[model samples]
Target: MLEKKRVQQLDIPSREGYDAIFNSNFLEDVPAALAQWGSSRVLLVSSKTLAAQHGDRIAALQSALGSHRLANTKLGVGSHSPYADVRDIARRVQRLRADCVISVGGCSYSDACKAACLLAANLAPDFTEEDMEALVDERRGIADARPEDGTPLRPRACRLVAVPTSLSAGEWNALSSATNARTGKKQHFGGWEGGGQPDLILLDPELAAATSPERLWLSSGVRCVDHCVELMCNPESAEGRCEGLHGHAERGLRCMLGGLTEYKAAKTRARGAGEKQQQQQGTQEEKEEAGDKERQLLLEGVSECQYGSREALTGLLIWRVPMGPSHAIGHQLGAVANVMHGVRLLATPSPSPHSRALISFKTRPVSNLTLPPLQITSCVMLAPVLRWQAANLSNPHYKTAQAKTLAIFNETLGWREASAADAVERFVRSLGLPTTLRDVGVVSDEEVRRIADKTMTDVWGGGKRQMEFDDVMEVLNSVRG
Candidate 1:
C-alpha cells in the first residue's frame, strides 16, 4: 500500500492467444475449427434445451464434418457441472474415442465438458466412483498448495472447440468448476498445467443473442460486469496507471458497458419488428434478414468482451490474478447449495433462520485481516485516490492505452453522479437481475461460514483479494436483505 513506485509487469499467456471467430454465422466455422484440430471423430456436448432450440443448425454442422464423423451428441448436462454428470460424459468420450469435443452452452455446460475432457485423458475409460473421488481430491489439494509446490495433474490431451451462447466468459478461461461428490462443494480445477484450456473459442453472437433473455443474458451479463469490475479494481491494474494489461481491462470495461446498452436497444427494436411482422405478414426472406440484422447488432456488443475479458481470463488461467470475494463466494454457493454460478454472482440468497442469527452475530468487522495486510489496508485507504481519479475524467493520463474507464461510467452509463458500486447496481437492476442474497434461495448461517472459510482456503487465481471471515460476513449481511 505504501509503495510509491513499483515495477510494471504484465503477462500474456502464449496459449492464451487462440483462434476465435466472432460472428452471427459462427457455426459455419465449426467444421473448420475441428479440421484444424485434425479431429476425425468429434463428440459434441450441449444442453437438451439448446439442442432443441438449434437442433437443425447443430445437425448441419455435423454434416459439414465431411468424411470426418461426429461420434455422438450428449444433450444432457445438468446445471453447476455436477461431478456425476462429468463422470458420465467422460465414459462416453472414452468409449467413443472422440478426438475432439465441441462444448456448446453456458458456463456450467462448458465447464462440464472441460472436466470431461480432462477425466477422459487421465483416468481409465471405465474408472470407478472411488477412483474419480480420489483424483478429484488429489487435484484439490495440489491446487491449494503454494504456487511452487502445486503442479496440477495433466489430463489426456484432446482438442476442445467452445461455442459460447452466453456472456459468462467461462469459454475464455482455463479453470473448470465441478462439485465434489463427497463434500458437495464446488471445486475449481484445470489450468495451463492440466492442459484444460480450450483449443478454440467460437463466439457466435447469433447464438448468444438467441438465448433466453432472462436466464442467459441477465445472469451472465452481470457475470461479465463482475469481470470488468474486478479488472478495474485489481491490484495489478494499480489504480489504472499500470499501462500493461490494465489498459486492456479499462478498454474492455468501456466496451462491454457500451455494448450492453446497444444490445438492449437492439432487442427492443427487434421485438417491435416482430410485433409489426405479426400484424402485417412478412416474407420468409424478410424474417431471416431481420433476424440477421438483430444478430449483427448483438454481435457488435459481445465483440467488445473478447478484448478486455480475454486479458482478465488469461491472467486468471495462468494464476497471475486472484479471484475476488464475489467470485469466491459464488463458487461456494454453487458448490455447497447447488446454486447456478451466474445466479450466485448476482444474489447470495438468505441463509436459514438459524444461520441468519449466526451470521448476524458475526457481522461485526474485525480489527485486522489474515493475509496480504498491506494490500487490504491499501484497498481501504485508496478510496480517496479512486474518487479523485473518477473526478478528473479528462486528465492527460486517461488518454493512454486503456481508455478513460471513469468517463465510460459517467457518459455511457449515465452514472456521472453515481458511485462505482451504485452504477453497477443500477446496471444489474436494468438487466432485471437480483441485487441481494435473499432473492435466489435460502442459505443457512452454517452455509455462510462454510462459504467464507472455503473462499479463503480454496486455491484459484485471485491472490491479491480474499475475504476474511468477518469481511465475508459483512458482504453477506449487506446483500442478505
Candidate 2:
C-alpha cells in the first residue's frame, strides 16, 4: 500500500508560481484579478450566506470586473447538495456565457463551481430531470455520457477558481463530491480536464479563519488524518520519495505537527475559562506566512488559483491525490449523519451491517517514531467549537452530554477524542460541543432504535462502505454507555 499511488496526494500545488491573493477586506484585489484572467467571460458561483456575510466581497467584483458576466447558485451544503443545485449552477453558467468561474464559501459552494465548469465546458446534452434519474440508479460510473450539441465529446474549454471559507481539504483534491437532489444520493466525479487548477486560486486564511471553529476543526482533522495515512499508503507522498528523518517529508511532517500542537494548546483553555479565540487569533504577517506554508505543504496536484492564465492551455490533467480509510470512512459518516465532516475522524465510526471497512493491515506500515500522531494532530488542527452544554439536548452540549446535538455552537476551542462513550461525552463537553443524540433531537428509546436502524442503512453513502444494522446498535449503545 505504501507504494500504491493512493488518492491523498492530489491536493497540492502542481507548480510553484502561484502568487497568493489575500486581503483582509475580502474585496481588495479579487474582482480585478477575475477580470484580468483572460478572454473567458468570468462566471461567479456563490451562495446567499456568503454573499450576505461578505456582500462587499461579491459586489466589489461586479464593480471592478465589469469585464465579465456573473451568475449565482445557492446551496449551503451543511446538509447536502441537491441535483437541482448542480443543474441551477450549470444553467446559470451557460446563461452568462461565462468562460471562467469563481466559487465562494464552503466546499459545497466549491463543488457547485466544479460541476458548473464541467457542464458548460463540456456542453453536455441536457438530460431532463428524468434522464439523469435513470443514470443514478445504475450501479456504475458515468455511462451514456454525451455532448449537449448531440455529439459525444469532451468539453470545449472553461476554467474554475475556488475561494474556500472553510478548511475543507476537498478544495485541494482532484475529485468533486455532491449530493443529487433527484436521486437523494451522494456522487463523486473524477477525471482530469476541467480548465486550469482554477485559472487562479486565492486562499486567504482570513476567510478560512472566519469559518465556524466546528467546521474548521472538522475539515482540518480530515485533512490531517489523510496526510498521515497517505504518507504511509504512498511512500512517495512526501518530497519526491525521500525516506526516514532525513528527507523533505520529515521536515514537512514536522511543521504540520507543530501547527497541530499549537492548535491543541490553544483549545484546552477555550471552555468556560473565558479566554477563547487565542487559538486562531493572529497578526497580519503571521496569517500571510501561515498561508504561504500551507500552500507549499499541500500535495502537488491541486494548487492555489493565484497564477495568471498560463498552464491552463496545456489540458488540465495529472491532478490527483491518494487517500485511505480515515478519509473514506469519515466521508461516509459525515454524509449519513449530517454532522461536520471532520467530527467523523474523532468519532471513528464503524459502518452499518452492509458496510464493513476492512483494511488490509499488511498494506501500509509505518512506525510511530517516524510520525507522531499527537503532535501532528494538535498542530494543524483548527480551533475547536465550544458553546453547547453536554446534557442540554435542545442546545449545544459544550458542557454536558444527555441533552441535544447541534445546540449553540461557539466556534472557538478544540474537542478532544475520548476513549469510551462517556469519555467522548466529557471531551465534547469540555469543548462546548454537543455530546448526545438527544442534544440534536432523536432521544426516546424508539427514537434511538430508529436512529440505529437508519444509521445502519447509510443510503447516502452509495454502498462505498457497508455498515450493517448491528454496527448501528453498537454506536447507539456506546452513546448511551
Candidate 3:
C-alpha cells in the first residue's frame, strides 16, 4: 500500500534534459508551467476520446491560453501515430505558426507531436514518402540536413510539452515513433540535434484517474516493469559504464511491483464495495462519497507509478541501452495485430486450477478452447524471452543475466526458489494479464513468423546478445501457446 503523504514535487536527474512536475491538478498547474516556458500560440493535440471525456478541462485550458495564444487544436490522432496524421499535424504547426505543441493524451499523441516537430523543422514542404522513410531509417538529426549551398539548417524553435495520461513514459525520451500508412509498419522518428523532445512533462494523477482505462493503467505499469527487468539483465549492464543503471532498475522494479499490486488490490476492494452498495440501494450521496475515496486511492497509486516509470527510464535514457526481443517483437505485434501498447484482457471468473497448472509449464502449450478472446499488453512477452535467455547457457552473458534476474526476484520481490522467468509470468498472471501471444489473438505459426521477421529490423532487435532471426523466432514461439 502507498504510504500517506502530502503531494510533493520530485526532482528528475539533470541528464534527462527536461523538467517534470507531478501534481494532482492540471487545471492550475498546466497553465502555470506553460507560463514559465513563455509558450504563447500553443497547438494542442489530443485524441477524440480524450476530447469528449475531458471537454470541460480542455475548455479551461483553452481559456487559460486565451484566444489569440491558442493557435490551433488537433484531435483524433490514430493509435500507433499514423504517418499521414503526423504529416497533417506538421502541416498544422507550420500553417498555424504555433510556437509550442502540447500533447494531451497517451504516448501516441506525444510521439506524433515530436515526429511532427522534426518533420516540420527539417523536411521541405513537398517532402516525399521516400524522404521521410529515409530520415527514419537513418535516424538522422538536423545536423545532417544541409542545403545544396552547404548551409546548415537552424535549430528548431518549436518546443514540446507532454501531459501524459498513461504510464507509457514515451514523453521522457527524445525519440518518437509513427506508423507508415501504406505498409502498416511502425517507424521511429527523431534524433534532432537541438530539439524534438518534451521540454516539460506534467504528471497529473487526476488526469490519469479521469482519462486512462483501467487495463491501460495497470499494464503500462507492467511495461515499466519490462523496462526495469530488461535493463537490469542487458549484457551491457555488466560493464563498468552501465553499472549505474542496476541501482535505478532495482528501485524501479520494487516501486512498480509494489505499487501495481497495491493499486489492483485497492481497485478490487472498491469494486466489491460498489457492488455491495448497489445491492443495498445506497443513497446518491453515499455513492458519491465512496467514489471520491476510490479516486483518491487510485491517485495515490498513479503517483507512485509515475515515479517508478521515471526511475525505470532514467538510466536507459541517459545510457541509450537498447531493450531486448520483447520490445522488438512488441513493436511489430502492435502494428500488425492492432494490439495496444499497454493493455491486458482479464479472463472472466478467473482460470481454474488445471488451467493454472498448464500455464505453469513454460514449454507446454495450453489449449485456448475454454478462454474468451482477449487482448493483452505487448510487454507480456517479456517473461518468456527472459526464460529463453536464462536457458541459453551457451550464451556468454546468460550467467550474469540470470543472476540479475534472480537478484530482482530475491531482492525486489522477495520471492524464493522460483526461476526468474516463472516469477515474472506468475506476477503477470496474478494481475490477471495474459502471458502468451495466443491469449492476445496471435495464434497461428505464420503470424508468429511474420512478427519475428519484422523484429529483426527494429533498432533494439539484436541488442547486446546480437539475436538472429532464428533466435527471435524461438522467443516468439515459446510464448505462442
Candidate 4:
C-alpha cells in the first residue's frame, strides 16, 4: 500500500535542474521567496487573460519588486509557443538585460520563456530566422550547443522562475517545444542541461483554480494520467535498469485517478446544489457562504490533482523515460491541426446540439452555439497503444510490462476487465471526456498521413519497437471512430 501523506509546503527535488515549491500561496509567499533568489531585474511573461484575471495580485507583485527591478512585462503569448513570439521575448531579454524571467501561465508560456532565455544566452545579438531553423535542424539543444571557440557555453545569464496556472506540468523540466510559424511545425528545444529550466517553481492550487477553465483543468489532469500510464507500460521500463521508477508511476496513477474522481463528484454535487438553491430562492448571504464552501471543496480536489501531476512528472523526468506514441502523435496534432494539448475526442456530440442551443438561448448569443470538433487527448490513445504493444512486440519484457500495467489498472480502478485499453476508455468516459479521432474535425486522409509522417520525426515517437508508418496508421485507425 502507498503512503497517504498529504503535501502542504514541500520542496520537490529535480534530477539535475531547478527547485520546486509546492502549495504556495503566490501573492503571500512569492515576494519573500524572490528575495532569496536576489534577482534585481525580473521580466514577467504571461497571457492577457491571466493578467486581467489577477491584476490586483500582479500589481502587488510589481510593488514588491519595485519599478526599476521589474525590468519589462510581456503579455499576449499565444498557444504552442510560436517561434516568432519566442524571438520577440528573446530580444526583450537581451535589450532589457534582465537577470531573471518569471513566467506566469500554462505550459506554452513556460516553454516560450525557456526557449527565449536559451536563445538570448546562446544565439547572436541579431540572430535571424534561418539561424533559429538551423539550431533546431542540427538538434543542438542547450546541452550540446557551444561557442565558436569550442569552449563550453557560459552558465545561463538569466534565471527562470515559473508560476504555472494550468496542470500541463511543463515547469518541471529543462526541455521545451516551440511552434515554427514559417513551417507550421512544432520544434523541440532544450536538453537536460544548462539554463533552460526554472530556478524556482511556485505552485498554488488556489491560483490555478482561479485562472484555469473547468474543462482545461480537468483535462490536463488526464494528461498527467497519460504520463504515469505511459511510464508504467513502457517496455523499456521492465528492464532492471529503471525498475524502481515503476513505484513512482504506480503511486502517481493512484493519486491522479483518486483526485480526478473526487473532483468530478464534487463538481457535480456543487452544480446540483446551485440549481436547487436557485429554485428555492436562497438568501444572498447564505448563497455566498455556500459558494465559498463549494469553492473550498473544489480547491481540495485541485490541490490533490496538482500533487498527482508533480508525482507523475517526477517519475518521467528522474530517469528520462521515453513516452509512447500518444505523446508523439499528439504533438503533431497540436502543431498541424491546432488542437489543444488536453482535448479528448468524443465519438458523439457532447451535451448534444439541441441542449447546447437551449443553454445558449438562455445565457449566450446564437452565434456561440456552434461547437468545434473534438480532438482526443494523448491519454485517450495510451490504452490502444498498449494493446498494440501486447500483440506485436514478441519480447518477454514487453509481455511482462503489459501484464503489470493491466494489474495496476485493475488494482487502482477496481476493474475486473482484461484489457487495459478498455479500462482507460471507461475512466475517460467517467470524466465526461470522449475517445476517438473522427471527432478531430473531419481529418482528411492526407492530413492523417501527414500527422503519422511527422510522428516519425519525434524523438519518442514509436516507443521501444520503433513503430513504422503502417504501425502508426494501425493505431490511428483503431481510435479513428
Q: Could you tally the backbone clashes for each prediction?
A: 14, 78, 0, 2
Candidate lDDT scores, in order, read 0.57, 0.39, 0.69, 0.68
lDDT tens readout by residue for model 2, 286-401 = 76675555433331111121111111111112322233222333343334443332222233232222112211111122232111011112111111111111221132222232
- Candidate 3 lDDT over residue span 1-481, tens digit each: 3332322122324324566777636677667766887878789997667678668778888888787678898876777787887888888888877788888887788888888887888787666666667654332212234435544444456877788887777787767888776665777765523255677778887778777766667767778888887787777776787757878888888788877877787788887987788678767998888878786777777788888888887666767676667777777777766563333344644342212423221222344322211224444588778777777647566567666666666675566736677677767776766667766667678777777776767776543345788887888877666
Better model by lDDT, 1 or 2?
1
For residues 232-278, could you state the per-residue lDDT of candidate 4 as single tens digits? 76766776777578887877777888777777888888889878986
Scored by lDDT, model 2 comes in at 0.39
Q: Which is the better candidate, 1 or 4, if ranked by lDDT?
A: 4
Q: Where in model 3 is the C-alpha error above 4 Å?
A: 1-17, 138-155, 192-194, 279-293, 340-377, 393-397, 406-417, 463-465
The local lDDT score (0 to 100) that residue 74 gets in candidate 3 is 89
Best candidate, lDDT-wise? 3
**278: Cα error in model 3, Å:** 3.6
